[model samples]
Target: MSQQPYAPRPQDPRPRGGTPPSGAPPYPRHRPPRPPATSDLRLLLRLTVASFVLAVLGGAVGLLAAPGQLTGVPVGPAFDTFVLVGSLVLGFGVTAGLYALVYFPLREQRQWAWILGIALASMALLSTLANAALLLVGPAGASPGLVTGALKAVVDVAWLVVAVRPGVRAALR
Candidate 1:
């Protein structure tokens, strides 16, 4: 068999002296796409704020439903203990919800929101666990104690899941 000779590389001629590729000065390339638009962000903010309000409302309802629970630290009931307890729940719920908002602007891709979301989720999980434990041990397994404990645990877990949702996180941001 005979080997073929190597051919020289050929250059294509430009059509009618058109602008040469890479000949023109480089134009500014756009920076990485700015995150989602402000309108979308506004929606998220609204959702986050609404969720926080809902949580506060839920706490108020819970307090109304049961008046004696929600004990503060130091093993003592301050003035208007029921109101104080309810207020605490509302405050905590609102704070947790608002905590989720900090990351909403970047909710679609924000790492901080993820961190905060995880923290909030952990809080919910902990609340559930503590409530479950209380139900098991408080008042030697009183019916109301068990019920309330279990109920609170369920609510916390549910809220945790909601807070961790991508859409929710984004909205809060």
Candidate 2:
């Protein structure tokens, strides 16, 4: 076989500096596609509203169910005053706090909202469990207590799940 010298391929007409041709973009332009709008935010809002409503209802029920005197405690001037005033204040204060501290700020996507929400949901879950326990062990009671406890448990669990969801956390951010 005869030996032959290698030949160089033809060079591109473009400049050697890696710059694009005149009037062309300096670099290829690429943008990542935008993420789809999350519907979880709307669901979170609806769930929050429902929770607010439930809190209000529970407050009303607490006031209505308030006993005239504290039971299983010694009857005295100081004890009576504490029982009467303390219960009312603590009950309503917690409900109001949940609204002001958690629900309102949550609408504005505050970072603390989920923290407070988790606490609130935990408290609610505990309360629901207590109510269910009372209903189960106390007596053959009316259906409302059981129904309300069940609903509250479900709502609280849903709140906890939604609060930790990736979409919900991103929406808050």
RMSD, one per candidate, in order: 12.6, 12.4
lDDT of each candidate versus the true structure? 0.54, 0.70
Can you tell me which runs of candidate 2 are displaced by over 4 Å?
1-38, 59-86
Q: Candidate 2's residue-wise lDDT over 29-130, tens digit each?
A: 785543443567567767877776776676555444544425666677788877777877887787777767877777777668878778878988898788
As a TM-score, model 2 comes out at: 0.60
lDDT of candidate 1 over 48-107, digit per residue (tens): 554455445545555565555655565556555766857797788667755556545344
Q: Which stretches of candidate 1 lie over 4 Å from their true place?
A: 1-31, 34-58, 69-97, 106-108, 139-173
**TM-score of every model?**
0.41, 0.60
lDDT: worst 10-residue window of model 2? 1-10
